[model samples]
Each structure stands twice: as structure tokens, then as C-alpha cells.
Target: MKIRNIFKGILIGVPIGVTLIDSLGYVARVDGISMQPALNPDQDQTDYVLLNKWAVKSYQVQRGDIIALISPKDPSLNIIKRIVGVQGDIIETIGYKNHIVRIPEGHCWVEGDHTGHSMDSNNFGPVSLGLITAKATCIVWPPSRWQFLSSSLPESRLPLNLSPPTLLYSA
Candidate 1:
């Protein structure tokens, strides 16, 4: 009876836990130097962030939001990046196919903070919002480095036609 109850408990508990993690959030280790200072600042240490699947479940994303998505270039891989331009925003690319691009509907431009080192939208163009799995909300590992990740896009990377932070503040 004792063994049966334990087995039953495990069966019931496993699915519930999986469902919560799938819908709520999950911890992912930051790999590579792509995100650089904002993420794995020290190559010797990897930062683990809480990726919130529920937050972007509606596909509402904005500039500066760090997101995890299925790699457009290679479906087998998942990549983490920052949202630089949302649908309808015009952006200047670093060295993408087009010098400037208008983010297409249902897609958004993403880039790594380390620029040249990242394989992001800068390399493959805007990614479909459908590909986004989650929004990175904070660092959860390496206690000394733990903190809520704040949304912040580099000034130079801001969308050209959209109001920049400076303009928004000045007006």
C-alpha cells in the first residue's frame, strides 16, 4: 500500500509540475558571449535567467525586452536576444541584408548586446513572434550576479522612425 501510494503520487505530481513550468517560466543557462555585459558578462561564469513564458504568451513584446526563441536559421537551436524593433518599426541594421528594414507584421528584430558575436535577427532578419518562447525576467543563479533584468535598448540601436528615449523624455 505504501509503495502504491508513492507511485501514484509521483504520477500525479509529474504532469502538474511540467504543466506549471511550461506555462509559467523556466530557468535557462546563458551560453556564449553574445549577450555580453548584460548577460554572461564573465565568460568564466554562466548566468541563469528566469524565462517567463506566460508574459509573452499573448505575443506582446517591446523594444529592450530580452527574449528566447526558436532559431530561425536552425530550428533545432534556441537563442536568447533582445528585441530591438517590433512590427512596423523601421530599424538600421548593423550588417544585415538590408541597410534599413521595416519590421514586418507578426515579427520583430532582435540582436545581441555583443553585436558582432551574436547570431540574431541581425543575421537572419526579424523573427516571427510565434517563435518567441519567453521573456527573460531576471538572473537566478550565481547569487552575486542575481538581479531583475531590466528592459533597455542601446540608444544607437533604437528604431529610426519611432520616438527614441531622448525624444520621449524631451517632449
Candidate 2:
């Protein structure tokens, strides 16, 4: 009887924890140097960042927001990248096959701060909104690294033209 109760408690606790993490936010360890000065900044120790899921639930991601998404080529993996272009905006690709691309409906273009080292939209193309898991709101760990990540796209990365009706659709 005790064992059964313990099992029940674990099952309930697990889901609650997962839901809280999904709805609220959680800290994740940075494994690579893709984000450069914005993230790890160093080669020795890593940083743990707070990823906010609440902010992304509306699918209203803005340019320069650091977001986490399930990799398109490999759905099993999750990658962190900055939003370079939103739907309806025309973006000039970096190393992508095409020189310029208009972010398709329900999709957004992502890129890494360290251009050459990171694998982002330049490699796999724009990602669907459904694939985005969360937004990196701030760096929570490491006292020296604590700060809110602001929305500020590099001037070179901005789209050439902004479409007036990005969210419009005709049924």
C-alpha cells in the first residue's frame, strides 16, 4: 500500500513540475558558444539562462528575441537562436542557399549571435511557430551575468522591408 501511494505521488508530482516549468520558466545550462558575448562569453565556465515559456505562448515573438525551438531537421533536438525576421518580412540571408527570403506564414527566421559557428535558419530555413518552445527572457544564474535580455536586433540583420499586414489572412 505504501509503495502504491508513493508511486501515485510521483506521477502527480512529475506532471505538476513539468506543467509549471512549461507555463512559467526554467533555467537551462548553456552547452555551446553560439550566443557568444550574450550568453557564455567565456570558454571555461557555462551559464544557466532563464527561458520564459509564458511570453511565447501568444506566438508574438519580436526581432532580436532569443528563442528556443525544436530543430527542423532533427526534431529531437532543441536549439537557441535570435529572431532575425518575422512572418511577411524580407530578410537577406547570410549563408543560406537563397540570398533573400520572405519569412513564410506562421514561421520566423532565426540566427546565432556567433554567425559562423552557429547552425540556425541559415542552415535549415525558417521555422514554424509551433516548433518554438520558449523565449530566453534573461540570464538568471551567475551574478555577473544577471540581466534582462532586451529586444535589439543588430542593424545589419534587420529586414529590408516590413510588410504592413503580417497577421492578415483571407478565409
Candidate 3:
């Protein structure tokens, strides 16, 4: 009787734990130097961040947000990048074939802070919004590095066209 109850608990508890992680958020390790100073500032020590899946459930993302997504080139791989342009915004490419690109509906331009050393939208073009998995909200590991990630884009990386203000008249 005791063994049977233990087995039952495992089955019930495992699913609930998985559901919470899937719907809420989980910690993920930063692997490469692509994210650079914002992520793995030191080459020797890696950072672990909390990826909030629930925050992006609606597919709404802002420019400068660091997000994780399935690699367009390799479906099996996941990559983290900063959103450079959202739908309808124009982006000037670094080394991409096209000098300028306009993010199409349901697509966003992503790039790594490390630039030349990273593989990102410059190599794959804009990625579909559906590919985005989660937003990195904060660093959870290394107590000294604990802090919320800020959503701020480099002035030079701002999109050519921003969405018009909804309020026509300001006070």
C-alpha cells in the first residue's frame, strides 16, 4: 500500500510541476558569447536567466526585448537575441544581402549584441513571431548578478519607423 501511494504521488506531482514551468517561467543557462555584456559578461562564468513564457503568451513584444526563439536555420536549436525591429518597422542590415529590410507582418528582426560573432537575423532574415519562445526577464543565478533585464535599445539600432502615437493630441 505504501509503495503504491508513492508511485501515485510521483505521477501526479510530475505533471503539475511541468505545467507550471511551461505556463509560467523557468531558468535557462546562457551558453555563448553572442549576448555578450548583457548576458555572459565573463567568458569563464555563465549566467542563468528566468525566461518568462507567460509574459509573451499573446505574442506581443517590444523593441530591445531579449527573447529566445527556435533557430530558423536549425529547427532543433534555440537561440537568444535582442529584438531590433517589430512588424512594420524598417531595419538597416549589417551584413545581410539586403541593405534595408522592412519587417513584415508577424515578423521581427533580431540580432546579437556581439554583432559579427553571432548568428542572428542578419544571417536568417527576420524571424516569424511564432518562433519566439519566451522573454528573458531577469538573471536568477549568481546572487551578485541578480537583477531584472531592462528593455532598452541602442540609439543607433532604433527602427526607422515607429508606431504612431495613439493619442492624437497631447496635453
Candidate 4:
């Protein structure tokens, strides 16, 4: 009787845990040097981050936000990058085939903070919004490094063409 009850508890607990992770968020380990000073600063240690899926469920993202997405070239791989351009914004490319590019509708350009070391929009061009899975809200591990990830792009990396601000008139 106890064995049967244990099995039932396991069945109920597993699905609930999976659902929470799928819909809410989960902890993930930063795995490469592409992000450099921002993430994985040390080659020997990795940082764990809380990836908030709920925050990006509507596909709303802004410049400088760190996000994880499915790799455009390889559907099975997930890549983390910082948003550099949103829809309709123009960007000056690094080693990309084109020297300049305008983000297309429903797509955004992403890059690593480490520049040349990353395989991001520079390699695959703009990525569709659907590819985004989660936003990295904060670094949760390595006690000394715990902190929120801020959304701020380097001045030099800002988009060259941003939409002009609208002026309002009141009577």
C-alpha cells in the first residue's frame, strides 16, 4: 500500500514541477565566453541565472535585454544574446555580410557583449520573435556575483536609426 502511494505522489509531483518550469521560469547555467564580462567571466566557473519565461510571453523585448533563444541555424540549440535592434531599427554590422541592416517586422537583432567572440545576429541576421524563450532576469548562483541583469546597451552599440519621438500638441 505504501509503495503504491509513493508512486502516485511521484506522478502528481512531476507534472506539476514540469508545468511550473515550462510556464514560469527556470535556472540555467551560463556556458560560454561569448558574453564575456557580463556572463561567464571566468573560464573555469559558470554562473547560474534565472530565466523568466513569463516576462517575455507576449514577445515584448527591449534593447539591451539579455534573452535566450533557439539558434536560427540549429533548432535544437539555445543561444543567449543581448538585443541590439528591434523591429524597424537600423544597425551597423560588425563582420556580417552586409555593413548595415534594418530589422524586419517581428524580428530583432542580437549580439554578445564580447563582440567578435559571439555567434549571434551578426552570423544569422535578425532572429524572429518566436525564437525567444526567456529573459535572463538575474544571476542566481555564485554568491559573490548575485545581481540583476540591467537593460542598458553600450553607447557605441546603440542602433544607428531609432524611431523619432512623437510630439504631442494640446489645446
Candidate 2 weakest lDDT stretch, 10 residues: 162-171
**Model 3 per-residue lDDT tens digits across residues 1-171:** 999999999999999999999999899998999999899998888899999999899999999999999999999998899999999999988999998899999999999998898999999999999999999999998888999998888877787675333576888
For residues 18-66, write the lDDT of model 4, one tens digit per residue. Answer: 9999999999998999998899898888999999999899999999999
Better structure of 1 and 3 per lDDT: 1
User: TM-scores, in order shown?
Assistant: 0.93, 0.85, 0.91, 0.92
Candidate 2 lDDT at 138 equals 85
Among the numbered candidates, top TM-score falls to 1
lDDT of prediction 3: 0.92
Ranking by TM-score: 1, 4, 3, 2
For residues 135-171, what per-residue lDDT tens digits would candidate 2 score against the true structure?
Answer: 9988877888899988778777889795233556878
Tens-digit lDDT string for candidate 1 (1-171): 999999999999999999999999999998999999999998799999999999999999999999999999999998999999999999999999999999999999999999899998878998999999999999999999989988998778889997554544643
* Off by more than 4 A, model 3: 162-171
Please report the TM-score between candidate 1 and the true structure. Answer: 0.93
117: Cα error in model 1, Å:
0.5
By summed lDDT, the worst window of 10 consecutive residues in model 3 runs over: 159-168
Candidate lDDT values, in order: 0.93, 0.89, 0.92, 0.93
Superposed Cα deviation of residue 81, candidate 3 (Å): 0.5
TM-score of model 3 relative to the true fold?
Answer: 0.91
Indicate the residue-level lDDT of 70 in model 1.
Answer: 96
lDDT of 3 at 167: 72
Q: Kindly report which residue pairs in candidate 1 clash with one another.
A: none
